[model samples]
Target: MVNGVLSPKETIWGLFSATFYTNVRANLYLTGSSSCLFLKSDHDDTYLADKEGTDYRYEKWFKNYSAIEASGMRCVKILDTYELTYSTRPDARVKGINMLRLPELYYIITEYYLSLENQDEAVKYFDKVLQSRGLTGYADRQGATLTLEKVIQERRKELICEGQYFFTQKRYNQSIYEPKSGKLYPASNDIYVFPLPENETEYRY
Candidate 1:
């Protein structure tokens, strides 16, 4: 895909409009968070969606923890694990925030849309696999039939409100209409608010 688009040396996901990255990095910092960490992935599906596992937050999880396989109630072997090596310098919170708030050094990419979602939330969701088993979680075909689609559906409950509805609608060929204003006519872009004084221009170019 790289060679097809540009030089073979061109990095992947070094593609895409970047209007979002700066905003994302700014939001993370404002919320007082650190981007320096890693998580380790132990399951064999490591290469599946987004390369970050089901969500972008697991990038660190994949770097810090190892996987463990166990046969629980349903006779299915599940990989379970939790928080691993996270060494944030104590002063990073008080000191580093002032010295230099570096922007996200690189654009993140993953196999699934979940792989590109908010990292903090992603970690909590998948970590639930180790325990949480409501009607909408973990698979157990030990007594039932779960085709590929069924197992895939099991993960959706974890992804709500994570900027995934757009991708989901696209994947399923679902069409979303623009929200109507006070009248029946569709709202135009001009009705969109203007940018703040310090932000970039509202022009689309």
Candidate 2:
């Protein structure tokens, strides 16, 4: 769950639950682990740097490619294991699953600013997310400058195979182009959007 305007001592906890035929597992991965990250505007001097290998920093961050690897693992573990499983209950699933967490909200906000050509604000928010997650190299993938395409591409990479990608695809009305076969399947028609269920229209419960 996301806490609004995280304080220096506050925390954001993520709950992931997967149910099987005879088994269920609920995992909790709190952002920053035991550390309390204070979000700051200056990129270089944040709580992470201040508490390196201590409250706000993890020793694993010292590895050359640990951030990327850890992000990949978290993405797979949370989205794949939990989201793809039985998360269909009303209150149970509602408390268990949150598709739009803080980082996601930040990403959406960044996307909005990027659409408005507000590069400064977009970069600020996007960097906030990256810094919060202790992820590097993403902000400077192409160069010093950030672009809408880069943001889209990074988001796609982060959320691939999750439930969000399909909706994003629909929002952009993205074409399903087959590179190997050189075929483009358009998604502008009714094929992409599902029709309303007959039960809902036919009767009111």
What's the TM-score of each model vs. the native?
A: 0.22, 0.46
* lDDT by residue (tens digit), candidate 2, 42-145: 32232243221232222321112134213212212222233334445334333233454565677788889988988778888887655554555334544466
* Candidate 1: stretches off by over 4 Å: 1-140, 175-205
What are the clashing pairs of model 2? none
Maximum-lDDT candidate: 2
- Per-residue lDDT of candidate 1, residues 1-205 (tens digit): 1001211222222323223323322322122234311111223242243221233322222222122311111101001111012334233112101111111111111113235544434333433441322222222213432232332333333222123334444554433442212233334433433456654555646
Residue 148 deviation, candidate 1, in Å? 3.8
List residue ranges in candidate 2 displaced over 4 A. 1-76, 79-96, 137-143, 176-185, 196-205
